[model samples]
Structures are given as C-alpha cells and as structure tokens.
Target: MTAHRFRSLLGGLALACAAALPAAAQNFPDRPIRLIVPFGPGGGTDLIARIVAERAGAALGQQMVVENRPGGGATVGIVALVQSRPDGYTLAVCPPICATAQSLYNPPPFNAERDLAPVTSPAELPLVLVVPRSLNVTDARGLLAAARVRQGGLSFASPGAGSSGHLAAEVFHRASGTQMVHVPYRSGAAALTDIVAGRVDFYFDTVASALAQIRAGEVVALGVTGTARVPQLPDVPTMGEAGVQGFDFPSPRLRVVAPAGTPAAILARLNAAFTTALADPALQARIQDAGGKAAGGTAEETRAELNEEAGRFGRLIREIGITAE
Candidate 1:
C-alpha cells in the first residue's frame, strides 16, 4: 500500500480503538456485582447495604449480590474485597470499622486508604447511649454521676473491640473522665440481651438496632453520640447537651468501596448509580426508617472523608491505647 494509504489506515485503527475503550467502560457491570457486608445480616449496616444495593443495582441495570462476612472486627469482608480483582465486580459496604481497621489491628491485613477505592457513602447512623430502665439514670449527667460513684465502674457492652461502639465508648471515657469496664460480645444482639437483663450497665448502640428495645422500654436512651439529635428519638439529647463537653465522635457510616486500582471510569459509574439511588425519595425514606440518613456525594468526597476519619481515629486509638480483643 502507498504511504498515504497506510497512514490513513493507521488513523482509522486509532479511532476505532478510542471508540472501543469508552464502549468497554460503559459496558461495565455486565454481570452481577458482588457486594460484601463486613458485618452479620440483619444489622443496620446490612440493612442499608441491601436497600442501597437493590436500588443502585436497578439503576445500573444489574443485580448486586450481598454476602455477609462477620468477623475480625468487621474486617473480614473488607479483606475479601481488597483481595478481589480490581475490576469493579467486587465491592463492600463497610462501616466505621473500615477506616478504624488501620489503627485497630496490628500489621493490618489491609490498608483501607491504600487498598480500597471509595465509591459513595450510602447512609450514616449515630450511636445512642442506652441503659436498662432499672439503672435509674434519666440522662447522661445522671449516668456519669452514677458511673463515677459505682464500684468496679459501670460496665459497657460493645459488639467487639475496635468496633465503632468501642471507639465511641473510649471517646466518651476521655470526654467524661469516667472509666467503664469494656465487655465485648460476639454480636450486638448478644450484647443487648445482657443490657436488657441489666447485666451490662450501658451500651452505645446504633439507633436502628436499639430503637425497638428503647420503644419497648427495655432500654432507656440517655443521649445520642452524633452532633444532632436523630429524628427517631427527638426527645433524646446529644452527648454534648447531656453535659459531656468536647465529645467529638464520628457517627458510623456505610461506605461503598471497591478494591483499589479499579479504573476511575468504573468508580465514577458506581458512584453515579449510588448517587442516583440515594437521591430517590423512596430510598431516602427507607433509609430514614432504618434509623439513618442517606448520604450521597462525589467519589472524591468519599475518599477525602475516609482519609480524614482514618487519621483522626488512628490518633485517637493510639492516644487511648485501645486494643482488639
């Protein structure tokens, strides 16, 4: 072929390749996506994951399969996600434990900031400080006073060491200057069982998980850990309002993340689907019913927030000397 003809052929091939690249990216998630929930089923995180997955999957024109992997302080599923192929097929809806994993575990199995690509945070739930009605503590101040005077200190229940509840308890200890014995349980249900029986003195549990018990009068809610009071418990006061000043606790959020090294195009696509899903009024209402607020933002926002949380939690964990049990 003539040189001119050859050059024309090369240009045609380049255009075809360029066209194919975008087509491939757009065709992403042609198959069902695997969504891992790092906690057990029926929990707030799992509920949020399932709801978000269903809606986002509908938007993506693909189904998302949610798998529960509950262990290792909610890091087992995260490790599985990080080890998966970074092809955007595998993702995980992780809790605060995702960011805290770095500080909570020694020689961490996976670096969240380094190994996971943030998609979008679907929902956020604040911790509620609940005690059995028999405790006779109507508010945080009362609870603190009671804790200070009680012998052996008041005991607090957490799902597990290094969990969000555990971290919140530690922060509360520092802010309130009251030492509480830590009693870690295999699951929140198990812990609540003891709390209801008045076996455990207190627990900082998710509003979703504790709402039923609170409504049933099995537990009395003293204060919410978040800056604002939750709608489900408008009568409840925030920790700060309850006289616990300087209590800076980050509410537990459900973040959608994929294995690091996933293509930016794929990440953007996933974010768009979730953002769309989170914006739906029906979906938002469902999230609210579950005791959480729908959170939707750009992928960059998610990454930045995760990084900040990692740094903050790492510093706090080190300062508090928290260790996994």
Candidate 2:
C-alpha cells in the first residue's frame, strides 16, 4: 500500500478503537475486581473495605477482592494503585493516611490528587480523645490544662508518625497551645494498649478502636474530633465545644479511588455500584455499628473532600514538623 493509504488506514483504526471504548466500559467487570486496602487486615480501613466490597460486588455482578498492601504509611499500596492500568479493575480504599502521605513523606511516591481518580467515599469516622482512667482529665479544657502543666512531660500515642491519630494530636497541641511528647507505635492496638496501661498519657484514637475500652471504663473519652458529637458516643463533646477553638481535625473519610486516566464511563459505573451498596439499610447499620456513618456521593464530591482534607492536614503537618520515620 502507498504511504498515504497506510496513514489513512491507521486513522480509521484509531477512530474505531475510540468508538469501542464506551462499549467496553459498558461490559466492565467481566472479571473479578481487586480493591486494595493499604493497611493490615482487621484495621478500620480493611474492615470497612471488606464490608463495602461484599455488597458492591453484588451490585456490580462480579467479585470484589480485598487485597492488603500495608507499608510506607499506607502509600506503598496507593503507589501500586497509581501504577496499575486504569481499566477500572484495580481500585483502592483510601483513608486519611492518603491525604497526609504526601505531606509526611520527604518525597512521596505518588500524589493522591494527581495520580488517583476519586470514585466515591464509602464512610467517615471521627477520632476521640481518650486518656487512661488513671489520668484526671474529663474534657478538652481539662486535658489541655493537664498538658500545659506537664508540658513535654505528658505523652500521646499514635498508630504511627503520620496516621490520622498522630496528626490529630498534633493539631490538638497546636490549637490548645500545649505540648506533649509524641509516642509512635506500630499499630493502633499497640498504642491503645499502652494508653490502657497508663504508659501513655493520651491518644486520639478512632471511636471504633476505642469504643470497647471507653465502654469498659478503661479509658476516658475527653472529646470527639468531629465538628459534631458522634452518635456512638453522644455525650462526648466536640473538642471545639469543650473549649479548644479551631480544633476540628478532619474526620477519616474512607474513599474509593482508581488509577488516573480511567475511562469516565467506567468510573461512573464503579461509582454507581459503590454508592448503591452504601445506601443499603443493612450496610448503613453495619457502618454505624462500626462507629462510622455511610457516605456515598458523586466522584466530584469525593475529590473535593479529599482535596480539602489534604490541604488542611498538609498545613498542619508542616506546622508540626512531622516527618515519616
């Protein structure tokens, strides 16, 4: 064939492929989908991912497999998600860790905003300020007073250097004008154990993780991190309400994201499936029981929330000088 004829043929083929893209998306998830949870099994993110996937898979007519890839402050798995093909098969469950990864890492492997496309947020949970029953604090003001007197003598525990709990504590110190020694741990359970043993003075832990302890009277919940009190702990006042102004730490939002450049049609389908799953009455109750509320909305809403959280936490991380160890 002549050179001109060959060029024309290539153009025709490109148009044909472009035309078929939407049809391909329409037949999406012909196979199982992999949902990566960037934390170890049994953690809040992993548990929430499993619950949502079990129901979303039914909506999508395919199996949604939960894959744990825990490392690098939850960025290892997110980096993997970023590198995956944007065909809508590989997705990830992103929590507050994702929002802070870029801020905490010296040079993050992937930018959550640039590399991942938000699908939807499945749930959100507030962190609660909990202290050992042995401590004498009962509210935010009392905790701040205690910290002020002790200065760096009092210590706060977190799952790790950049986890939500860690940043929340940092923000609390910044807003309350009190300083406390930061104690980083390998896991939330470990941190909670120390707090229960009175090894640590306080910890900002998720309601889910600290609920049992709070109910058992092992730890005292000083305040919740949300703008409003959490239903699970209705009597617990918000940090702002408890006397700490501008003390709202962004709640941990569980978002679903895919590799950037995924076809818009495919993203829409995935969003619909997940949102429908979140709307199920059984799923909402289960989420509430787990100390969170179901949150399902458009991809744009998720994107906005993630961006807002990243900006808010990034400023706090910089102000606190928190670096990944």
Candidate 3:
C-alpha cells in the first residue's frame, strides 16, 4: 500500500476508536439499578440507602431502587449481592464493616472482603452511648463509675453479635477499662425492650433510634460517639467530652460496593455519580436530617475504611475477650 494511503487509514481508525469511547462510558444504566441495603427499613442504614438511591438515580438518568435484605447482621443481603451479576446494575449499600463481617461475625461461607469491591461511601453516622433513663446513668463516665462500683456485673445489650453497636461498645469498653456483660438480641427493638425495662445496663445505638428514645425519657444518651456533639442531641456531650479520652466515635457508616471483578470503568462511573449526587444540597440536607453525615471520597477510601474498622474491631474484640456466640 502507498505510504499516504496507509497514513490516512491509520488516522481514520484512530478517529473511529475515539468515537466509540463515549459509548463505552455512557452505556451504563440503560435500565434501573437495584440498590441492595443490608438492613430493614427506617433505621439509619435504610435512610441513607433511600437518599443515595433517589439522588443517584436522578443523577445517573436511571432508577436506583433500594432493596432490604436484612438478616444475620447484614450478611444475608451481602451474600445475595455477591451472587448478583456484576453489570453495575446490581449494587449494595453496605456498612463499613460489611467487608469485615467474615472476621468479626460468625462464619459465613463467603469472604466478603474477597467478594466485594467498593464504589463509594454515601454517609457516616456515629451512634451514641446510652442507658435506660431508669438506670439513672447520664454519661459514659458515670456509667463507667457505676460499672466500676458494680464490679463488672452491669449488663448491656446490642442488636446482634459483631454489629457496629457491638463493636463500638467494645471500643467504649477498652477506652473506659470497664467490663459490662453483653446481652445480645436479634434486633434493636428487642434490645431496646430490655434496656427500657432496665434489664440491660447500657448500650450504644444509632441516632435514628437512640435519639428518639433519649427525648422520650426511655433512655438517656450519655454522649455522642463522634468528635462533636450531634445537633439533634445538642445537650449530650461527645464521647470524649463525656470524659472518655482517646475514644472517638463508633461510626455507623454506609459504603457502596459491587461483586469483585467489576470493571474499573464501572466503579469510576458509579463513584462519579455518587460523589456528585452526595454533594447536592437537597441530598446532603436529607441525609443530615435523617441523622447521617454524608461523605464523598474515592473507592480507595471506602476500602481502607472497611479494612481499618475490621482491624480496629478485631483487636477490641480480642482484648475485650468477646467470643462469638
């Protein structure tokens, strides 16, 4: 072939490849995207899920429907997600430790860390340390002092084994050097029952649940788990402010992920949509109003946060001698 003809053909081929690039990036979400939430409705996780689904769906020009598959401390929905097609249409709204559930919770056949790849973090909400109002404990220090007087016999309740509440309680336990008996329950309602009845000594719960109970005089939030006191629970001090030094928040954070082997392009696309949508005033206000702190970051941040929480929790559990039961 002539040199001129060959050069012309190469230029035309390059132009054709450039034209297809847009299709490759934009072909996503030709239909609805199913958002799998690993918890029941109305809790902090549910609220975040709905916010992301609604906002991202609007941004992506597709529908993002949230599906609750709550069971086994979010393991059930995750397992279902792992088994889903990795076409970017099926994504999961997972808590930070959804990746570490394998190490923290009872043996599920699959390793979540190996099975999932992060898309983005929608928001994070720190739970509060609280006790039944009848317990007359108004602060973590007071509770610790009372537990110290009780000699490690004060009982506490958590939603389930290895849940964020359970792990955060461990963090509180380590920081306060207090040993309180854990009373495990299938759900927060069940745990709250015993707590309000004064059968359990203390517990930490997400704002969506704990704040309501705190205002009703059913439980008293000793303090918030974050660095600053939440606006809704303004009267309550932070965990550190409540006299537990070095004890930061035990966060109830949500991250999005897909089954491993999903393409990086898809992850990047999803992350862009999430990052953009989360910054919108309506979305941010809705999330904050629902007792969550929206966070937008790269996929690496989500992965690192999950890993850090797992490592932190694993040590706390072992140090506290928390055995899986």
Candidate 4:
C-alpha cells in the first residue's frame, strides 16, 4: 500500500477501536471477576476484600472470586496482576505494600505507578502501637523510657518486611529517637500472638487485626498511628495526642486496582460498583466493626492518594535502607 493509504488505514482502525470501547464496557464483566488478595486468608486485607467483594460482585451482577497469592513481601501476587491482561477481568486488593514494593526492592520488580491503575480505595485502617501487658507501658512515653533503659532495647514485630506496620514503626523510631529490634513474622496474627505471649515486646498492627486482643486486654494499647483515634478504641489516644510529636501516619488503605492500560470506561464501571458497595450502611458497619472506615471516591482521587503515599513511603524506605529480603 502507498504511505498515505497505509496512514489512512491506521487512523480508521484507531477510530473503530475507540468507538467499540464503550460498547465493550457497557457489556463489561459478563463473566466472573477475579480479585487477587495479596495476603493469606483472615488477615486485615483479606477480611476487607471478602466484605467488599461480595457486595461489589453483587453490584456488578457477577461473582468476585477472592484468590490468595501471598509471597515476596506481598509483591508476588501484584506482579502476577501486572502481567495479566488488562481487560478488567482481573483485579487486586492493594495495601500499603503496593506503594512500597518498588522502593523496597533493589532494581524493583514492578513499578506501581506504571503497572497498576487505581479503581478506588474501599477502606482505611489505622495501625495501633501496642505492647505486651507484661511490659506495663501505658503510653508512647512509657514505651520510649522502657526502650531506653532496657539492656538490648525493645523488639517490634510486623506482619512482614516492607509492610505498613514495619514502616510505621521505623518512622516512629526515628520520631521518638528510640531503638527497637525488628522481628518479621509470616502474618500479623502470628506477630500479635507473640506479643500476647510476651515473646515480642511491641508491634504496630492494624486495628482490624489487633482489635480483639486489645479489647480482651491481652495487649495494652499505646497510641494509634493516625491523626484521629479509632471509634472501636474510643479511649485510646493518637500518636500525637499520646506525646509522639507530630507523628501522624496515613492509615493503611485497602484499594482496588487493575493492570495498567485497562480501558477507562471499564475502570469507571468498576469504581461505580465498588463505590456502591462501600456506600451500603451494612458494609460500612462491617468495616467499622473490623476497625476500618469505609472509603469511596472517584478514581482520580484514589490515584492521587496512592501516588502521594508512594512518594512518602519511598522517601522513608530510601532513608532507612529497607529491603524486601
């Protein structure tokens, strides 16, 4: 074909594809949608995923199957997600780890900004700084004092390396000028169990994972990592309120994301379905009961939030020299 003729043909194909997008989106999700949970079952991310998946699936008139693919600092599943077809059929539940992975790894695995597209963050759960009851540290100051006086310093546990809890504790350590040994566990539940048994000195765990233990007095609440206190722990103080100066960490958010280059129309549909699911009073109540607040907004807002978080955590990880290991 002549040059001009070939150029005309390409333009026509582009126009045709553009015209077909809306129709494809209108009939989007005709089959079941796969939602990848980047953690083991029963953890905070998994819990929120199941709660939102059921309602979102119902809204989309399809089943949102939850698939657990936990490993590699929660990046294994996300890498799989990034490599999948960007047809809106597969999605993933993104935690703070999603934003931290690139910065935490050498050479990086997948760039979150380049590989994933945000749909909406369904919920935000703050981390609670807790200590074993055996320690008798009632507040942040007490914990600091204990850490300073202790022979080997205190030990802190996280669900895994590069997790929000791990980074939060690192931030806390720097802000408070205290030293704490890092203990990485397979899951938050395992870390919490060690805390209760006095095997671990302290942990910065999501309120969702630690609420039951906190309520049962198995562990003592020091302060939350957010600017505001959690309703579930009404009497507990925020890190700033508890005397860790200017210590406010964005609560770990649970987000819905698709592989990059997914159709914008399809993303809009997914966002709407999740927004509708999050608006349900029953779902909100369930989220609150699980120690998270329901979050819903436009896809742009979700993207902006994730980007800002990635920047913040990226700077922190670089400064502290954190690695996935």
Best lDDT among the predictions, by candidate number:
4
Candidate achieving higher TM-score, 2 or 3 = 2
Q: Write the per-residue lDDT of candidate 2 for residues 269-302, one digit (tens) a residue.
A: 9999998899899998888788787889999999
**TM-score-better candidate, 1 vs 4:** 4
Q: Candidate 2, 112: how far from true, in Å? A: 1.7
TM-score of each: 0.93, 0.95, 0.88, 0.96
From the highest TM-score down, the ranking of the candidates is 4, 2, 1, 3
Q: Which stretches of candidate 3 lie over 4 Å from their true place?
A: 1-24, 105-108, 321-323
State candidate 4's TM-score.
0.96
Candidate 4: tens digits of C-alpha lDDT, residues 31-146:
99999998889887788889999999999999999999998778888988999999999999988887888788877888988999999999998899999999988888999899
Identify the runs in model 2 with alpha carbons over 4 angstroms from their true place: none
Tens digits of lDDT, candidate 1, 56-100: 999999999999998887878899998899988999987888778
| RMSD to native, candidate 3 | 4.8
Q: Model 4: residues >4 Å from true position, as ranges?
A: 1-5
Model 4 accuracy (lDDT, Cα): 0.90
Deviation from native of the Cα of residue 9 in model 4, angstroms: 3.4
Per-residue lDDT tens digits for candidate 3, residues 1-325, read 9999999999999999778756766898689999998888877778778887888888889989999998866777888889998878899988744745656655643575688898888887878877877777767777878878886567878987777778777677767776667788888778877888888888788886666677788878887876777777778888888888777655667889998877777788899999889989888888777777888789998888888777776676666666545
lDDT of 3: 0.79
lDDT of each: 0.88, 0.88, 0.79, 0.90
User: How many clashes (backbone N, Cα, C below 3 Å) per candidate?
Assistant: 0, 0, 1, 0
